[model samples]
Target chain A: MPNLRVHNLTVSLDGFAAGPRQRLEHPLGEGFEGLHEWMFAAMRDRADGKTGIDVEYVERSEENIGATIMGRNMFGPQRGPWQDESWKGWWGDNPPYHNDVFVHTHHLRPSLAMEGGTTFHFTDEPIETVLGRAYEAAAGKDVRIGGGPATIQQYLRAGLIDELHLAIVPELLGRGERLFDNLGDGIDGYRVAELVGSPAVTHARLVRR
Target chain B: MPNLRVHNLTVSLDGFAAGPRQRLEHPLGEGFEGLHEWMFAAMRDRADGKTGIDVEYVERSEENIGATIMGRNMFGPQRGPWQDESWKGWWGDNPPYHNDVFVHTHHLRPSLAMEGGTTFHFTDEPIETVLGRAYEAAAGKDVRIGGGPATIQQYLRAGLIDELHLAIVPELLGRGERLFDNLGDGIDGYRVAELVGSPAVTHARLVRR
Candidate 1:
């Protein structure tokens, strides 16, 4: 069976996956970039032909992800009804995701086919239904939960996520949307499969047992 | 100089040092024991003639501290004018701390001396004033910040804590008292000096530059 996974979901020390007031300008809100400095540096190192645990983890995030399912917020900042249909997401031409990307949204919009063999499919279905759609789109490969915290929280609370790789940054974001809110002992059954530490971040991979 | 330090403070993946609704039965709150499983195991190992990073960290928590400063909540659950004067502490007869421990409280109370060199000095003074008293009592030795989050938060916010050693547990406590709450970019001045990952806990020591 293809595993449903979440990889490299960066969170602040206070467990905020995204800082408050996420908009087009901020993307991850004010000062939240400090949370992903390690990944950004790793990406830079990868561009410079360097390979290590951090680089490997960054690369491995998209290893078997045949399809991705992200929330509407992650698609863009425009909410309560799509204002502009011209919005092709933050990713410009040749988006990083080169496969079927499923977006969870309430409004109905036609499927969008972008460059580099990527396509965006919007749906308002339940998580399981979306997972089913994602599996079919994945074609036997793994399904990636591209989270904005609320989406991942739903999957976690429903015991749908199989693996989670969290990058915990050692900075406090004070006030923001907390990822672990209302989890209610949801992380009890999971065990730490692996843990790696760097000067910038601590990577923890948890597997549901 | 006697460095003011916080050592072996355990926080969940969600950054909560203690769970919600602390009561007499559950000191660390319900299910919070999972956060300190590594510490509990380390204590057992210490009794069984074992030594490692976990044990070392636990042992080092009390290494050179001659005095401790804690909040009234850490002392007990008593609130508003100390209903029971006979209530010494959770530690019966002799407490683990073998030095002068200052308890921060709004209400005034007399100093109570327990066995094994542990004396609870109740004071409503400011953190700096209390630290001064603790320094005098410590007699050139290091002063420890024995935390219940709020106390440490105060010291941390005031830039009084020189060093902080935090144990990041792999579990998620949905609701509780967070250690990093109201610490807006409070950890920016500190850097991770050391990080060690064991099976149950990942220890990160932060030092202010």
Candidate 2:
């Protein structure tokens, strides 16, 4: 079976995965752009044909990702009930994920078929059930847990992730959605399989035993 | 001039310098031992005559320091008022610090000279005033900012810290006295000059620009 993985999830030095008060105007929340500035620089290097540890890690994120699972907050900034059906994802035209994407939401909506072979399926079902559907959709390929911290926390709490690539950014967000909160005994069994230090971020690969 | 510096302070993956509910039995607080496991291991290696990055960092912390400044919390767990005059410190007769140590406290206490060259001087003065004394006491050597998170936060807020050597441990302390809280703009204008990754921890040197 393909491994369930979380790749290239960058967090602040204070462990904030994303800043607080996430809205339409500020997609990743205020002062959060600094968190991903390193990733952007890595992307630039890759575009210029420079391949190193960071570029290799970035390239590995897309290796076998056939399907993805994300929280509703990552899909959009809308809270409570979904008022308008016209609202799509934050990504314009073509999203980065080119495969089937399962979004966890209380309010159900029909499957959204977007351009570039990406489809959005909203669900209120249990995480296990959603995982089963996503695994079936993936069909022998790996499933990616794309997150905004809360969704990743649920998966981590459930002990469903096989491996995680966490990039520890040097900046301190101070206030934001911390990635390691409310996780009881969920993070006890992981070990850092590999570690790499770069100018932008400190990257560690956590493997579950 | 002697530089004001913080060295070899271990923190969790979440940027917590020390864990919650610090007391006599649990000096570093509950579950905080994991954060310093690397330091202990490094000490062990040093005892075994092994020299590496961890040992180098530990040795560097003691290289240039003369006097030290710490918060009341680091001095002891006694809060509000000091009833017992016998409470010298968590460290026994011969404390690790073999120099003048100025402790910031609201309550007044007489200076205690330990078995070693260590001497504890209690003060109710502002951080600047205490630093002035520490610098004077140092004569020429660098003054170290020994911390319990709150003390470091204050010095950071005042922009008195010239450099910081932070060790990012592998474990997560979900809740604790966060080192990066309530400083407003204190953490800005600093850059990570060097990074070292080992089995136990990832150490980063932050220099103010």
Candidate 3:
């Protein structure tokens, strides 16, 4: 069976996946500027990027992923009904994801075909239904859950996620949308499979038990 | 000036310092049984204990501490006025803390001197005042902030702690008393000075910057 995986989800030491008040200017919200520095520093193409554990994990995120699912918040800064349809998304022209991407949203939109093989499907369907569609689109490949914290929390609470990889950044966001809160018994099924650290971040891989 | 430091404060990957519904049988609270296994495995006296990063941190928690301060919750499970003074503490006879220990409480009780150098002084004094007394008790040695999470949060909010060391255990308690919640701007003054990981746990040291 193909695994439903979430990889390289960066969170602060305080457990915040992203800082408060995410906007166009500050896509990841405030106080989260340096949160993804470790991943960015380990980019495969970058000349100055460090090659080690961080890079290896970054590479794994793209492996065997045929389809991606994300919350509407992660797609753009706009909320509620779309003010303008002109907003193609944060990524310009050809996005990195060259596969089918499902966007979880209350407001429905027509299927959007982008420059690359990427096609954005907007759906207001329940988590299970959306996941089923994503799995079908994956066609035997693994499904990847792209997150804005809330999206991942939904999957986590439902116990639909098979593997969760977290990069714990050593910074305190103090106040923000916490990734681990309101989990209740949703986290009971998971256990830590691996824990390693670089100078910049600690990587914890949790697998469903 | 003697620095106020916190060490070996273990917290779950979800950021809970202790699990919920703390009681006599459950000292660290429910769902937290194996949270401290990493430190326990690195005990200096244990024949089978492993020595390395985990052990080094455990040893650091005991270094240069002339006095220790903790919240009432950390001292005992009993709440409100002490129904019975018979409960010296969770530790029997000679406690590990061989120094003057201050317990922050709203319901003050007479000081109970235990075996070894451990002496529990219960006081309803303000955090700053208690810290002042603890500093004086230390003479010139550094003071240690032994926490139950709430106590540590208070000192962190006041910016009184000079150094903070956290052992991030790889477990999901789901629900518990979080160490980082309600910190607000209190966490702004600190920065991650060191971060390392063992197979069992990840250690993060935050210093006031």
Per-residue CA lDDT of candidate 1, range A1-209, in tens?
Answer: 99899988998765688988988887887768667788889999999999887898899897888999999888888888887699988899778889999999998699999999889999999989999999999999999988888898888877888998988776656667887776656766566677667656788887886
- Candidate 2 TM-score to native: 0.87
List the lowest-lDDT window of 10 residues for candidate 2 chain A.
Answer: A187-196
lDDT of 2: 0.86
Q: What is the Å distance of residue B81 in model 2 from its true position?
A: 4.1
Give the chain A TM-score for each candidate.
0.95, 0.97, 0.96
Evaluate residue B180 in candidate 3 and report its C-alpha lDDT on the 0 to 100 scale.
Answer: 89
Q: Which residue pairs clash within candidate 2?
A: none
TM-score, model 1 to reference: 0.87
Per-residue C-alpha lDDT of model 2 across residues B134-154, encoded as one tens digit per residue: 999998999999897899988
For model 2, residues A1-209, the per-residue Cα lDDT tens digits are 78889988998776788987899987788879767877888899999999887898899988988899999999999998979888889898788899999999998999999989899999999999999999989998999999979888888878888889989887767678877776777776565577677756888887785
Question: Each model's number of backbone clashes?
Answer: 0, 0, 0
lDDT-best of 1 and 2: 2
**Strongest candidate by DockQ:** 3
Which residue runs of candidate 1 sit more than 4 Å off their true CA positions?
A: A40-51, A184-191, A198-200, B40-51, B77-83, B184-193
Tell me, by TM-score, which candidate is best.
Answer: 3
Would you list the rank order by lDDT, best first? Answer: 3, 2, 1
